[model samples]
Structures are given as structure tokens and as C-alpha cells.
Target: MVEIKTPMLPSNKPLIVGKIDVRVGDHVEQGQVICQIETAKGNHQIKATEAGTIAEILVEEGREVVANDVLMVIDEQGKIQPEQQSESNKEILTTVPTDTVQHHLEKDLLIIGAGPGGYVAAIYASKRGMDVAIAERKKLGGTCLNIGCIPTKSMVQSAHLFELLNEMDLFGIEGDFHASINMEKVLQRKDEVVDTLVSGIEYLLNKNKVTVLQGTAHFLSDTEVQVGSTIIKAKNIIIATGSVAASLRVEGCDLPGVIDSTAALDLHEVPDSLVVIGGGVIGLEFAFIYNTFGSKVHVVEFQKSLLPMLDADAGKFIEGICKEKHIQTSTSSKVISIKQTVEGEYIVTYEKDGTTSYTIADKVLMSTGRRANTNGLGLEHTSIKTNKRTGEILVDEYEQTNVPHIYAIGDVSSKVKLAHLASQQGCVAVDHMLVGKHPISDTNVPSVVYTNPEIATVGYTEQALKEQGIPYKVSRFDFSANGRALTMNQTEGFVKLLASEDGTLLGAVICGPDASSLIAGVTVAMTNGVTVEQLTQTIFAHPTTSEAIREAALALIGRGIHQ
Candidate 1:
């Protein structure tokens, strides 16, 4: 028996463009308005392009419909006319038996989650001739794509663009410009980027012949995982389930106006004023974006400083910048309770310096930190253990768990929560499985904060050296001294370097324009164990922001050319 599938469309002939109106299995007659196509011009009524019951609507409403794409199908007395491409179906009709073409489920390596880590493991392991299977609970790409990093970054980009336009006068560009964000459109573009990338991941998984399962994964035992009751046996398993936003426990914490960092990304309307709880990376970054977007942002952090792991001086620099942006920041301010007002606002009560105070805002964002999603995975059934305080899985340098056959490589295990670290760990874990030795450490990994000026750091902080009793010399270069920064009118931050007494490069912090990109060269140097002398020896492009790195390195030895 042959099954036919076709996309339903309007009979307007020239084609009316709008959102899809009919759903799958919706019966339709000739010339019926089956779907609404939204064109940039406006919505257009799409009539039934065929005379039959509606088989399916492949796309959703509010989504643009394109020509030649399968919109839906119709069946006239079992004679199916599929409007979409059917070449693959014809090939299957000619050369393959349905029973014979069934995919065998056995795999040598099975990974759970397809975020940065899991997908990388699947690709790398598959390249090494391992049969790979990846199970994801939702979309092919995990939280980073579907909810967290990608979406938030896109919003940040938009906010930054708005900021740039607002400051165009500094560049001697004169124009009367006014722009307002359409929140729905901003979110639509983010969704588009995520959809494209997630679909790309699906393609890569299929190209690698990795069996993709869509369901929750659980450990059936040490060497096996169960996904939707399907037992997948493998020689080894990699658990890459990532972290989620950590919420604080306080009165009225579950109020409707309160949201996590991820939830803030999906908000339809921008709040008039937002109170951000926790001044960590996530909180500050969002605060910068929202402040730029015309929201009155007030940040409350329990710690005395922002980004506590960063250098104290660096934190001060960020505080200064936040002040310049008119963002209200309070450190050592602990929230005691959250109450919902009759006006639908959130009243946040807090104590600081032994005094209780309160503030009201349309919304409160919880950005304290993230904890690993280890619950409900049935890990208690196995010998694997997790840290009681943080719930992070215990893993050796080789990314191996207590059971040799199981490996963990992500927020589920490591201190570094960045996505790139997870991808690298995934590769290292696979290599350990194949090579039987060698492992990687979280040390020397570069961390970047995507705030206005952008902060990127790598290796040891000066505090770390002091704590470890490692003798180190400190050096610095200010963007105010750089010719490029002077020209760009962005001389607001500096680069600081910490090196050993013997001049071995230890770590560096960059806080300035293009800091995210500028740190890559320094990161590469640190990763390759390059020395300060080697870094200074390499000529940097003159009048470029990157030359600051070289200048900063030269300052370590007290011979910087510019400073």
C-alpha cells in the first residue's frame, strides 16, 4: 500500500501569502479558505488549491509560507497528490524493502543530549568508527539552542545594535534616528536562528549515521540506557545533560512577575522596570541589555562584588561602567521576600547594611546561578556519585565516572559552565574512551562575559596565584593609551596580565571594545603554553585593538612601547 502526502495551499493561483490556517487531518472542500498566508504586505486568504480532505499543514500560523514548499496534502479516493518533493519516496519505491531497510539500534557509543557537548561527541566518536546514537528530550539541539545561550545572545546583539545607533554621534555620524523594538519580531528572528542551527544539527547527526532518539534518557545499568522504553546497549555512554537557571527560595518567589534568565528571553512585552536578583554574569548581562532597551534595571547581589571569581579590580571597573549606564547596582543586598502588589507589580524586600528596604518593579529576574539537571535520571541505581552541595557529577581527569563504562562531560560535571568547554570535554572524553589514557582539565579555559565592553579572561586570576602561593608579576595596558581606541572613542577599559616571576604567562583579563575577539589570541597563547616573551616578539597590527595585548605583555617586563 502506498501512502501519499501533499501540502495544502490556497487556490488564489498567483498565491496569497500568510500563515497556515488548517491543521493536519482537517477536512477541506474545493475553494475553501484553508490557510492564511502572511506576506510583508499583509495577510492573504489562501483557498484550497486542491479538491480533497486536508491531509496536513506542515507549517504553523504566524510563520511565513513560501512557494514550492509543502504546505499540506489532499486525498481524492485514495489517490494522493503530494505537493512537496517526493524523489526520495520514489527511490524507496524502486529499490528498498520496508522490512529490509529497518535501522538496527545497536551502537558502540550513545550520548544523551544534543547540545554543544553531546553533538560534538557523536560527531567525533562516529568519525572514529564508533556506532553512535544520540537521544534528546526535545529538539535535536539541547537547552543552549532551544532556550538558553543562543536566544539570549541574539537579544543581546539587538540591544547592542540599538546602543550603537544611539551613540552614532560619537563617531561624527549625524542623522535623526529613532528605533523601537517590536518584541515579537525580535523573538521571531531568534527563533529563526535557533531553528536553522538545530536543523543543521539534525542534518549532521543523520549524515554521521547517528541514530537520533527523541525522548528522556535513563540509565538502565552501567552500560545501557533506556529511552522511551527502548533499551540502547552501548560499550560506553556520555551524559551531557546541561544546567538550568537556579532560583532562590524566598517569600512569593513563585509569583507570576518573577522569571529566570531563560524565561526572560521569551517575554512578549518589555517591562517598564526590572529588578534583577543576583549580579552574576547572567544577571549583569541581561541588565545591560534591558537597561539599554529603556528599562529601569536595578541589580541586587548577595556578594559584595559582581562576578566574584574575577579580579577585584576588574569587578570595580564593571561597576563603574554599570554606573555610567545608569544601572542601579547594590552589592551585599539580600532579598528577604517578594510580594505581589495589587497593581500587578512585584515588591522586592531586601536587607543591606543591617537595614531593611523595599523596591517595586514590573518583573524580577532570578539569575543567581545554575545547577546541573541530575534529578530523575535514576543515577542512584548506579555506582556513580555527585557532589552533595552542587549536585555536579564526579568525574576523573579523563571524564570518566565511578563506573568505567559511563562518562560525564558538561555542566553535569565541570566547574566551567561555558558551552565551548563542554564541546572540548566531549572530545576529550571520547578520546579517553578510545586511547585509554590522557585527560583534560578545566584550568586554562578562557571565559568571556558578553557585557557592553565585553570581558574575557583566561587561566589563573591574580588572586588564584596569590592563593596558590605562586610568585607572579602583574602588568597592565589601558585602552586610553591605544591609538585605535582613541580613534574609535571606546577607550573605557584595560587589559591586565599576570605572569610568573620567571616571565611564563599565567593569565590575562581584557575589558574593552572587541574584547571577546581580542582574547582569542591570548587564549591560544595560554593554551599552547606560550610565554610573555614569545607573545611580545610577535608583531601586532599597528593601530589595532589587538596590539594592546602585545603592549600589555611588554608591560609585564616593564618595557611596553605605548604605555
Candidate 2:
């Protein structure tokens, strides 16, 4: 079997399909001129490379197609193997020199980069009955599944298990337990989890009949994209190429022992001592993971507090947790240089409070931040707007770019580089395209950090409210007083809620056991305008961590069941 695809014109725009010399179910001999196309250079004939029967005619005579757009499919009389259909499509040529054409049909939508944002939007759009096609050059489930979220969480689980081995006595369980991690097995398990999710994405895409194009995609035109040998044209396009791990512009950053978050996840073995630069989400997450894995981990940050982007109290609270976990943190510090020693240790130099300092470690990780991956996307030729500083595509509240039909979601455009936010933005963009109205507001988006006790926050932070001088009531319910937390012996952080004077739920931040799961209820409340009184009145099972939320609500109302 072979595909008769549309060859490109002199330019990458759509070619006007002209004369059609063949029809579906028609047998044609070799060297037959099957169709003619109107091209930018001139008119040209599309020919059959070998004798074949036309199994499909995907385009009308008056339709338009770009190069590598599939115009027809042919049974090549066994001359070409079915496996070579792809190569045959690539080989099909137009009469002109600069362009060739071949493709089955145009899609209603084309999404570039199959990351969380792209895949989620793809599935959602498919459910909306849109014929979607997604192009992923590498793995199916971009960074979150393959490198960022899933892998880091898997490592965290193993590290937590190892950390627990030393604290068994605290739980009233006694054993002369000795535990160690086989890094190979740990990495193998992470890969297994990632592979399963990636395969699941493929299954969903296939089940939805969305064309899964596997190649690095480049924009051919505002409405057309080229992936490998195929040029795909769609009514709408979404760019969801997620960000990549960026490094610090310091000396010796590219040295052998220096690594990024992705490299940090797949280390051959946990280093005896590690220096993590940047106190942001990525740096701190890895810092805690390696710390629990028995590595002497130290974090250096340019900001005044850890997680500088989050609330001040959240940073301070997590700082205390880091200290309790023995993970050294150096804030208000800037990494100046990293030099290697013959002894195989790296001496990291930084300046803090106008003083120079140094630390030695077996490995140095740069978790500074990520840059927008817009290079080689061919956006330079288009009028699509982008952020001048970050180079990320600039989208409106509806997730639509200045170019109406091109939407940018996820890390490619978002200021907040979170997987869930990306997924949400994706759905919003799809909804905006189909219905011209987005159903959800991004204001109540929830964010969680997978720390020891976890940190989850939704809606406004206390700092933002204060800075804006918003009238709000605040209450903090310490987990120390919660029966469930006390019984679980994991009471460490508190549940804090901010509400309006009249009792409308304004914001929430949790830093304790089940924080990740507990934040969902708080987010729902804040999103749906659940008031403090209503939340307190809502039935929460006794002795459950969720009771802490109701207690916090009660505390905000001037009288509390327990404080």
C-alpha cells in the first residue's frame, strides 16, 4: 500500500487541487498523471510512481492542499510493502522541482508537542468530535510524565520509604532495619511508570482516531505545519511544546558533575554530597528527594526566601521543614562559580549578603528555571505575538494568541509552568475555539509542591492580598490539634484559610499530611463561592484530615470547635 500525497508548491501555502484524472476504485498503470494542482510557481501534475488501484480519493478537484498532504491512497500491486507506505508518501513527487504533495486529509486541529497541555487538549477536542492530529517529536507524554512530575514523585516515594526506615521507632514499630536504594531499580521503576502513562496516551489518541504524527514539527505557514515528510494544514493549531531545564550562566556549569533536573532524576547513584542551585520548585523538590536518599543536600538561591514566587509564610514554613529534615538552605545567595577539584569534588562559590562563600559537593545541580522552547518552530516568520522577555507566546485570557486560529497553551505560553495549569489552559483554549467562551476562570487554580508534608495553595496568597490591600479574614488551624494528624503522628504544618468579612471563601494554603488531596476541597469551595460558614457546616467525617478545613473555617468565624 502507498499514499498519494500532495507535493509542495513553490511555497508552503495550500495548493489548489485542479484536474483529477483518476477516481476511487479506478485501476491506473504506472506513469499515469493522477491529478493536477495549482501551485505558487505554476500548475503541476501529480503522477503515480507505480501501477496501483486507487483505494481512496480524499480530496475534491476544487479543494486546496499543502505539500505532503495525503491526496489519495493506492494499492501498489505489491511493488511496495505496506510498511514502506510512509517512505512511499515521502517519495511521491510533483512535476515541479521545489514542491511535492501527499496527505490523506486535513485535520480540524493540529496540536504541536504532546505534553500534558497538548495531550489533554487533544483528548478533550476529540471528545468534542473534532478530527485532531497531534505531532510529538519524542515521547508521547511530554516532560511531566517522562521527566518532570511522575519521575520526581516516583523518586520521592522511594526516598520517603528509605527515610522512614530510620523513623520506624517513632511509629511504635521496632526493627533493626537497614535499607538502601538500588539506583538502577529505582530508575527502572520510574521508567516503567512513565512508559505505562505514555502508552496510555497513545491508546487514547488512537481510540479517538486522532492522527498521531511522530516527528519534530515546524510551522510551514500560520495555518500549516510540517512534520517529517508531511505538511499538515488544520483549521486551528495549538502549540503546547513544554519548557526545558535551563542552566545558570556560571563558570563550570557544563562540567561533568553539573546536571539539570532531568539528569538529576536518572543519576547512576545518589551522590554522597550534592549542591542544588536555585531554591525554586525544581531545586527544592530534588533537594528533599536526595536528602531523604541519604545525600548531604544544600540549596543556594538568589531570592530572599525559598520558593520566592510563593507566599512569604509558605516559604518560611517550608524553610523550617527543610531545617528539620537537615537540608541546608542558603537564601539571598547567588552562585558565581563552580570549579572542580582533582579529588573529584566540586567547589561551588556564591555571594550572599555581600560576602563570598563556598561549598563542596560531589555533584552540582542547576535548577534555576526553564526557558520557552520556541526556537526552530518557524514562528519568527509569523506575526504571532510573544513575550519580549521570556519569548513565550502571548495569549489572551481565552488562551488564544494574537493570531486568531493559533492558540498557545502550557509552558510554551503560560507564566505558570505547571502541568495541571497547562492542562486547564488547554481545555480553555479548546472551549474558546469551539464555543467562543471559556467556562472556567484561572483565578482559583491550585498548585501543589510534593514536599515531605506537601504544600498546596489555591486562589490568593496572604501576601498578594496584603499587597493589594484586599479586605480579608485569616485563620490558621494547626494540624497539631487534629486527631487524625495526631493519630497518624505526621502533624507538622497548618491549614490556613482567608475569607472575606462576610464569610466568602477567598483563599487557602495547606502544609501538612494529605495537603495535596485536601487542597482540592478548598479549591472547590473558593471556586464555587463557598462561604466560611457553609464550609464549617459541611459534614466532615470525624478524625479525618479534612476536618482541619472545617476547623479553619470555624476559626475564621470568631468561634471554633477546636483551636
Candidate 3:
């Protein structure tokens, strides 16, 4: 008997079975197209590896399947043999007999959702000599590696390189270069980077001797989970089921040309025009990307500014930069509806200042945001608690839920959804579970937006200080005055510092080149409770982007030497 299974795709997400070309009792030849599978990139035809009679079809059309999932079984010469099945095969056929006694595997820890949070916890717990098992419904790296962070940044880098090549004359390098965006090659490179990182994660999990179960896991009890048909009795279980992209309920949102961020990443061809419905981090990143790739990008933001969560100055600076780049942005606007024309173009209707306006585009990207995914986890069976407003699992500072033995972390928890934050929470949760109670705080978490100039912030913002009635002093250092910024010809933003009257470093925000990397210094200072005086005393390298940070610190103390 030959078992036909689903082939691995570049994406970690499951593919939907599109069409079945054969039925049971049908004769098939080798290399024949047996079925079609729909992936994010496009449709793919599944072919037979060998000639045989279709003995049984295990899966049906429209069903989502992951890599190595059995689709059908073929019998050569129409003969059936009774042979001992391998252990791996037994795990795949998870359904046990009703009349047979159900077997349960015991583990010290069981983690649901093998995202950054789950896998990090698994490895940390395993290193502490605790047996760990992680059950994941999709790929091991979860959304951040497979879709969110790595893949998007890969495309961002490609777009940045493409834009830089077009403006090489500004760098004193004169060359007649004809460059166009090759989306196919760009996607291929993104897939290669994702696959390599995923493989590395899998290797680390295996090296730590953590058991990886491939299936949906649900809570059977406070200390037990059912993955497929296998029951795992664990001393503790951590829920890390990340989040899903939010859906817009406006008209024409379900149309073919309208897609979410996930679909946006897999686009093979650059559209002539793109309408982005949100002005958040994800929306702005894609706006800059498609715009740099020669698309006329229009961003309609419900809020009055781009990056509403960021400082007002930062948002205004980015808005100005967007205008300079020929990217149209409509602030204080609400998308009323979207309509598709017969010619396959999209008309996006939005209201701004109580006046309705329309923009035409080849495609529409909904970058609204994401919500915690806790739908089918069987949380009702346990005493686990969730937030009514946000639908996120409620956890204590130690990352523990109402039930002491079961905990929740990452996007599932009512906390920030960054991958690095999730990983840190995972480590902290493991420490609390195994060693002692050491709660992790979210105060100093760094936030970064990967726009053209990039924006990063740590600690409290100036607005927050004013709202809280805290006395704070402000210092500013524009990258325009920095030697490195002038040499790079990318000076467009500034580094602002908010310090207390007593010299305590309250916060720092950088909106220029390498801001993402520069914010780490501020993060370290804030985490260690370092004051502005201490920061000013530290020597920064000459002609570097990070020197702006030290200059901002010096300005706070009335010691600005280089303006």
C-alpha cells in the first residue's frame, strides 16, 4: 500500500484541497495530476509518484491539509497486505478504537501553539530537565516566522534596495541602472529565508529533546490536553495560540481583489494602484513597500494621523515624508465601502471631514490589525478566564491564568503581541513555573515601525508624562545636523528625549535611519534605571547614527556641544 500525502509548500500555512482528479477504484499512472491544492501564492497540482489503483481517498476537496498529511492510499496490483504499522504512522492515524482502552502520555509540561512563546518555553523547560511536549496546528515558527515579521521584513529589505538603486546618484555613484521589481524572485527569496529560519528552530527543538505533536490541541482538563486523538497528561500547560488578522465588515470587503496582510505578502504582480485601509504599522510598511515598487499607494486612516500609537511629532514627520514620496494619505477618514468594477478595478469610498471621496485602485489591502485566537481551545471546560472586551486570555503578572496549573502567554494573553515580547514572556513563564515567581513587566518594551526612515521608542512618551501629570524636560537632536545623516543623505527625522527634572531618563524616541537598532541603547538604560547624566557620560562613536542618542542626552543637561 502506498500512502499519498500532501507535499510541503513554501508557506507554513495549510493548503486547501481544490479539485480531486481521481476516485477510488480508478487506475492512475505515475506523474499524473491527482489533485489541485490552493496555496497563498497560487494554485498547485498534486501529482502521483507511482502508478497504482486508488484504494481509498483519505481527504476530500475543500479540506485544509498540512505537509505530510495523508490524502489517499493506492494499492499496487490491487493487493492488500496486513503489516505492522510504524510508530509515526500510528501517530498520524490518531483516532483510537472506542472499545480499546485510551492511552495517555505523561509529561512535565505541555505547550499548545508552537509559536515563539510555546517553543521558547519548551526549550527553556527542557533545559531545566523537565520533559516538554509542544502541539502545533501549523508550522513550528508560527505567524511571526512564517508570515508576520520575517517575511514582511524580507520584502521591506527588497523594496529598500530597489529604491536605493534608483537613487544611486545621490551617493556620488553615477551609473545608468535599469531596475524593475521582480516579485517572483522577491517572493522566492522570502520563502528561502523563512524556510531556513524554520529549519533552524526545528533543529533547536529536536536538540533539546522536546516532543513535537502536529495537530490542533484542546483542553481536556486543567492539566490535560487532547492533540488529535492522543491524550497528554501534563503537570502544567501553557496556552500560546497567537492571533488572527481582523476582518472588515464593510461592503465589498469579501471581494476577490480585496485581501488581508497575509495575501498582500504573496502577491505575484505589483498592482498599478493599492488602497490601504489602515494607517497602522502594518499598513504603513506595506504602503511604503508597494509605493517603492512603483505602485500608486493611498492610505486611508480612521485616525487623524499616521501611526496613531506613536508620538504626534513622529506621525507628522512620517506623514510629511509620505507626501514627499508621492504616497497619498487621507487622515481622519473612515472607509465607507469598496466596490469592484467590471474591469477588475476597485473603487474605495471613504469619508473625510464629513465629505465622501473615492479612489480607484487595482487592489485593496486591509491592514486593520489582529485579535487573539482562542476560539476552539475548549477553554470553557476549564476554569481559564478571558477578557470580555479584547477576547484575550487573562493572566497574572507571572503569566498564569485563574487555574494555577494552566498558563497563557503571547498574543493569547492580554499583553503586547510582539514576537520578542512573546519570547521574553515565555522565558519568564517557564522560570515562574519551574524555579520561582519572577514577574516580567511590559513598561520598557521597545516598539519599532519598519517604515522608510524607521521609528522606535522605549519607556514613556511625552504625552503620557503630561497625561499622568509627571514633570518632565524635553531635549531634541535632529538627524539633519548629524554628520552621518548628512553623509548618508537620509536625514529626515530627529531623536527626542524626555527626561525628569532630576536627570532621570524618562523616555526616548528616534525617527531616523537605524532607529530600530538605536532604540536598544535607550531600552537598556531604561531597564537598568539609568539617568540622563549617566547616558551623557557614556561615549558614543563619532559620525554614527547612535551618536544622536548621546547628543540628545547631553542636550537635556545643557551641554550640547555639536548642536
Candidate 4:
């Protein structure tokens, strides 16, 4: 499929979609004028870049459009459409899709869940000449694409853009500008982004000729599975069933005002006040997101500090930033109960240091954490081994469960539920089958929290090094000292790097602008076993956030330059 995006006109500002010259199902040749965009400079005609049938027209007349906004999705010639399925009963969605091309049940590979792990594996295995069929009881893209990673990041970008518009004076833009989040439009844009990506995945899967099935699936035996009335027997199987948002079990937690992460996304109206019950990644990300949306936000954490998965230094700095933003917080406090007043307001009662106090809000969020979602798979039907405590499928380095032919990768297999990591595991599993031995070490997986002044970490944290009694040298470089950060007006956090006495890189943490992107360079270096001396030898572009990486590396070698 060809995506026609709004072009970058002479003026870099957003443009208004004046008129659309094309319609869905209309086929046009290359270079045909498709629409007109009214911009600050003048009206510019949008032309079709490729010859295809217009599958979708995303915008209408007078709609304010921006560069890179998907103007249309062109269904290119010869593109195979994946069979679609929709489940009306959410109660029985535990099984995967069952549709098949060949009616017969035998297959080369059968994967459950159309998430990052399952879909990526299906495409790759098909490319390697394997007959692959993936069954998804829900949407084509699983929770990460539909709810967790992609959706949250989409809202984060909108919130950040809102913040930037409000602080335009810092950029010397002289105008009476008032920027407020229009939640309805904000949600529409978010849905557009998700739809674009989901459509792309569907196209890729169909192009690869993988069989698409939709319905509930379960293990009929070790080598056989049941999808609806059909029983499928495959040479190998992979379970990529992902996790779901966990809710707290305190009293009144089921009240109408109390919500989970999924509920937090679709809150059409910004609550006058909000109380987030957990301080982990999900909790803090939403806390900051809604805070920027003009809510009186309060975060209550059972942990002594926020983001307990991260190192203490990063967590402490984040707490300070929250305080600066007027975000109320209470640590080492456990919620006793939540009660809704007759007036529709909620009172959150918690106890801290042997004292109980109450706070009131319009909405209560239960962001405690997530657990492995291994429900309804009928694991008992097979002899596959699973973790008794966490219920996660036990797998080896190759992502192969105790049942050799049955592999499990992603949230269903481990507690570290990252979408990219799940994709990596899928690749490793397929490679192992194709070559006899393929193992990908996940030691360098980076964790990113989409909070303002985003936090990213890879390898070991200083706290972990100390707990294990490992000797390591540490270095720090504040973004306040970075020229580029100063220019962007985002100089709030710092980069911290740790290394062994021998100058080998151990771990690093980034807490500032572009941390999500910056962590990739560190992860690449660590993955290839690059040392501090080797990294400092490489030149980084000047006046960029990435230079802070080299500065931290230099400090690690006791040869600091910018400091």
C-alpha cells in the first residue's frame, strides 16, 4: 500500500486541506493532482505519487492538516487483502482467530496472538518458505499496538506538542498564542496514527501470503490446537499472548470512577482532578500526560520512590521534576480504599507511616502493574511447563519451552514485557529452527518510560552493581550543560554512564530530551562490546543531544572535555 502524506510546503507550518480531488476506490495514475492544500504561502496542489486505487481518504475539506499526516492510503496494484474478523463478545476473546486458506489443519508454523512477536514471526517465517498461520481473537495488532506502547506514546507526543505551543515565547515566536488540548481531535489523531500502522502491518502480512485466522484457539494436545471447530496440527507453535493491565483489589476499586490503563486512554473529558494509584512506568507516564493536559494530578505510590524498576538516581530526579511541575505525590503510602461521593467525586483513602489520610478526585487510576496473560489457552491440555508463581511460559535462550516444538516469546514468556524485545525473541526462535542454533542475548534491552523528560536505561543500574558487589566507575553529564538542550529549552535531566575499572561499558541511563532515541546508540555499543575508549574516539555531531553521550563517555575515561 502507498501512503500519500501531506507535503512540506514552502512555509513549514500546518496547512488546511482545501479540497480533495479524489475519492475512495478511485484509481488514478502517478502525478495526478489529488487535492489542494491551503498554506501560509498559498494553495498547493497535492499530487498522487503512485498509481493505485485510493483505499482511504483521511482528511476532509477545511481540516487543518500537518506534514506527514496520512492524507490517503492507496491500495497498490496486486496487493492482497487479509481476511477480516470482528468479535462481538468480549467475554470469549481469549482464543485466537481460526480462519484458514486450505481448510485442512496441518501447517508449518502456528502462532497465537497477532502482536509484535507473533506477527513479526509469521512474516519472517513465511519469507523463509514456511507455511505460517497466525490466529488473533482480538484486533490484528495486539495490546501493544492498540493499547499499550503505541497508544501511550501517541498521547505523549500530543501532550508534548501542547506544552511546546504554550512555551512558544521561549522560541521568540511573537504572537498572542493560547494552546489547549482539544481531546476529541487529539483522540482522532491518535487513532489515525494507530490505524495507519495497523493497516501497514496487515498489508505486510497479506503480501507475505501468511494465512490469517480469527477466533479463540487452544491446545488440543502438544502438537495440535483447537480454533473454533477446526483442529490445527503444526510442526512448531509459538505462543505470543501478551499481558493486560492489572487492577488493584482494594475496596471500592470496582467503582465507576476507578479505571485501569485502558480506561485511562479513552477518558473523553479531562477530569478536574485525578489520583494515580501506582508510581511505576504506566502510572508516571499517565500522571505526567494528564498533568500537562491541565488536570489537578496527584500520584500515590506504594513504593518509597517513583519508577521502582529504574535506578534510584533517575527516580529521585524525576520526583524533583514532578514537584517543580506542581504534581502532588505521596510515597510509601498504600491505598486503603476508594469511595465515590453522592456528588460523583471520589475520595481516596491511604495509610502512610501509621497514619491514614484521604484525598479526593474526579477519577482514580489503578496503575499498579501487569501480570502474564496466559488465560484460556488450555495449557493443561499439554505437558508444557509454566512458571507456577507468575504463570509465564518457561522458555530457554532460544525461546523454546520445555516442549521443544512449542516456543513462547513475549509477555507470555517473561515479566520484562517490551514490544521490541518480543519481536527480537521471535526472530531468534525462527532462526534457531532454520539453523539448529540461534540465541540472542537480551542483556542490553533498553527500557523507556514516556514521561516528560523521558527516562531510558540499558544494561545495569548502579543500584544493581552495588547489590552484586561489582566494582564500577561512574560518570554523569547534565543536559543543563549541553548547548543543544539549551537551544531546545529542555535542559532538565542528565545522562549517567557506568563502566568497569578496565574501561568497559557496564550500563547507562538517560533522562532528558531524545532519551528514547539516544539510548539506541548506547545499546548498540554495549551489544557489540564497545569500550569507553573506543566510543570517545568516534566523533559526534556538535550542538546535538547525542554529544552528551560522548561527553559522558569521556568522563568515564577521566578525559572530560565540555563537562
Q: lDDT of all the models against the reference? A: 0.82, 0.86, 0.88, 0.87
Q: Which runs of model 2 end up more than 4 angstroms from their true locations?
A: 1-105
Which scores better on lDDT, 1 or 4? 4
lDDT string for model 2 (291-348, tens) is: 8887999999999999988767789999999999899999999899999999999999
What stretches of model 4 exceed 4 Å from their correct place? 1-103
- Cα deviation at 383, candidate 4, in Å, is 0.8
lDDT of 3 by residue, 1-563 (tens): 88888766665567899899999987776757898877765566677777778999998999999877899888876532225446764564455344244557899899998888889999999999999999999998999999999999999999999988966887788977888899999998998788757756765787788998887888877878888767999998899999998877899999999999999999999999999999999999999999999899999999999998877888888999999999999999999999999899999999998899999999999988889999899988888888999899998898988898888889989557888888888888889888767898887889999999999988788778989999999999999989998888888889999988999888888999999999999999988889999998898998899899998999999998788
What is the C-alpha lDDT profile of model 4 across 262-284, one tens digit per residue?
Answer: 88888889999999999999999
**TM-score computed on alpha carbons, candidate 3:** 0.84
Q: Mark the 10 consecutive residues where model 2 has the least summed lDDT.
A: 93-102
- Answer with 1 or 2, whichever has the higher TM-score: 1
- Model 1 RMSD in angstroms: 8.6
Supply the global lDDT for candidate 4: 0.87
Q: Backbone clash tally for model 4? A: 10
Give the winner by lDDT: 2 or 3. 3
What are the runs in model 3 whose C-alpha is more than 4 Å off?
Answer: 1-103
Give the Å error, residue 71, model 2: 38
**Of 2 and 4, which scores higher on TM-score?**
4
